[model samples]
Target chain A: MALLDYFLRSKEKQVTTASKAKERLQIIVAHERNQRNKQPDYLPQLTEDLLAVLRKYIPVTENSLSVNVDKKDGDLNVLELNIELQEENSGK
Target chain B: MALLDYFLRSKEKQVTTASKAKERLQIIVAHERNQRNKQPDYLPQLTEDLLAVLRKYIPVTENSLSVNVDKKDGDLNVLELNIELQEENSGK
Candidate 1:
């Protein structure tokens, strides 16, 4: 019985921290949604064009490419492109 | 001289297409910068906190994690989190 309680206590501690993190993320994510609604409509078009160009040189799927715009300063913004490269002929 | 011209023509074709893509990206990216300026200030903080949470469960580096908020519908927004996982004990 003591062993069961010990394991349960440890499991609860882990859950507590993880759930706290999730709650925090939910709040921040909600705020982010408000800001994102104001973004320009050109983002989707840009993503599609960039993906088409990248596909010409790299073997990438829709899941592997993401484009984002991050605010740097008052007037500066950074266009971030992420592409996950897969090994060619991976023998896995 | 004929062989040289053939190689030059092929190289020029490749360069022209790549350069055209680059120029298009540049123009769209410039427009994106303007829209990104209105994004909320909590993005960096949200990214850091999410990274910290992820580190507790996954072996990820700064370069492997990115968080972005993407607009979905008129009132909905999607918070995208990307983490590039590395193999454990890679026998390379």
Candidate 2:
């Protein structure tokens, strides 16, 4: 029973860690999206502010954005931004 | 003539750099999206392989992924992945 309990606990820990990593990735992605939509001249300043806000809550790993522009009927362009998070691997 | 030539060369250099940066960013974003769609268990191995491929060509900055799941009519889940590239700043 003790061995079984130990195995169960380890599995639970792994699950928890994976979920936590996913959550962190979500936040970083959001930040990256915001940065990409920003004007090129303003990106650096905005990125710094975002990093500060994120650091206040949880420790973030890495944040970045990928932006795509979709053209409409006219000359207007719609931007789609993707944000991503990098999680540190902690092997058990 | 000398002053005009110098001005034109500087502007040309700036345009070249901006274009190059944008191209690099696009490649990174594509890679990130690919990674996010991959299964969790295979992510590490996939990431390493991708990095190796990217490194052989031009120098890449930083790459990451963010994934979102959207539910369709019934039980179909569509995954949206965002990939991003981090460019190092070199103010000239």
Candidate 3:
């Protein structure tokens, strides 16, 4: 969903931190059930390339978003991104 | 830090999922102390644009990375992305 709809829909509602964290995580993790292994150099490049493109659309500085891969077991690996977005008013 | 460094350093340690989640979050949240208000339409564009660029570097399809913005106490807001990465072996 777009940010404008989010603000317009929830402008009166108060979302809790714990709720926010999990809900956001569910959205991100929901799609990540697929698994793959990556070369060591790829993730950083991915993050950089992603930011370069995201910057064209949003105000993403160096620390605004982070992507990484972590192993679940010896065989299972996860790719995760933690992003900090601009406030709704500033996004314009 | 680069992915190579993460692998070389973490090659031995057994990082748990609970631990993994927090560690990843710490990396994502560590830098978000700065605050800003954003327009609502910015987030989906950011996620989409980021993925478009990331796909150029890695094998990211539709269900790979997820980004969202949530609120706390109405004023404190968060931008979060949960990304699933390729396996290290598959990356090469």
Model 2 scores a C-alpha lDDT of 0.33
| Best-performing candidate as measured by TM-score | 3
- Alpha-carbon error at A34 in model 1, in Å? 24
TM-score of chain B of each: 0.36, 0.30, 0.38
Q: If both were scored by TM-score, which would come out higher, candidate 1 or candidate 3?
A: 3
Q: Per-residue error at A16 for model 1, in Å?
A: 36
C-alpha lDDT (0 to 100) for residue A47 of candidate 2: 42
Tens-digit per-residue lDDT, A1-92, candidate 2: 22223323433454345433322222111111222334343233434443454344334443454433333222122333334444446475
Q: Which is the winner by lDDT between candidate 1 and candidate 2?
A: 1
What ranking emerges by TM-score with the best candidate at the front? 3, 1, 2
Give per-residue lDDT, candidate 3, residue B14: 34
Question: Global lDDT for candidate 3?
Answer: 0.39
> In model 1, how large is the Cα lDDT of residue B29?
10
Supply candidate 2's per-residue lDDT for B21: 32
| Candidate 2 per-residue lDDT over residues B13-90, each given as its tens digit | 543454333222111111122223343332334334434443433244434444343332221223333344444455
Give the alpha carbon lDDT tens digit for every residue of B39-91 in model 3: 34344454555455545644554554555556545443445554454333435
The lDDT ranking, best first, is 3, 1, 2
- lDDT per residue as tens, model 1, B12-90: 4543453221111111010111121344434345345545544544445566555445432222233445444332333
Steric overlap count per candidate: 0, 1, 31
Best by DockQ, which number?
3
Q: Give model 1's TM-score versus the native structure.
A: 0.24
Better of 1 and 3 by lDDT: 3
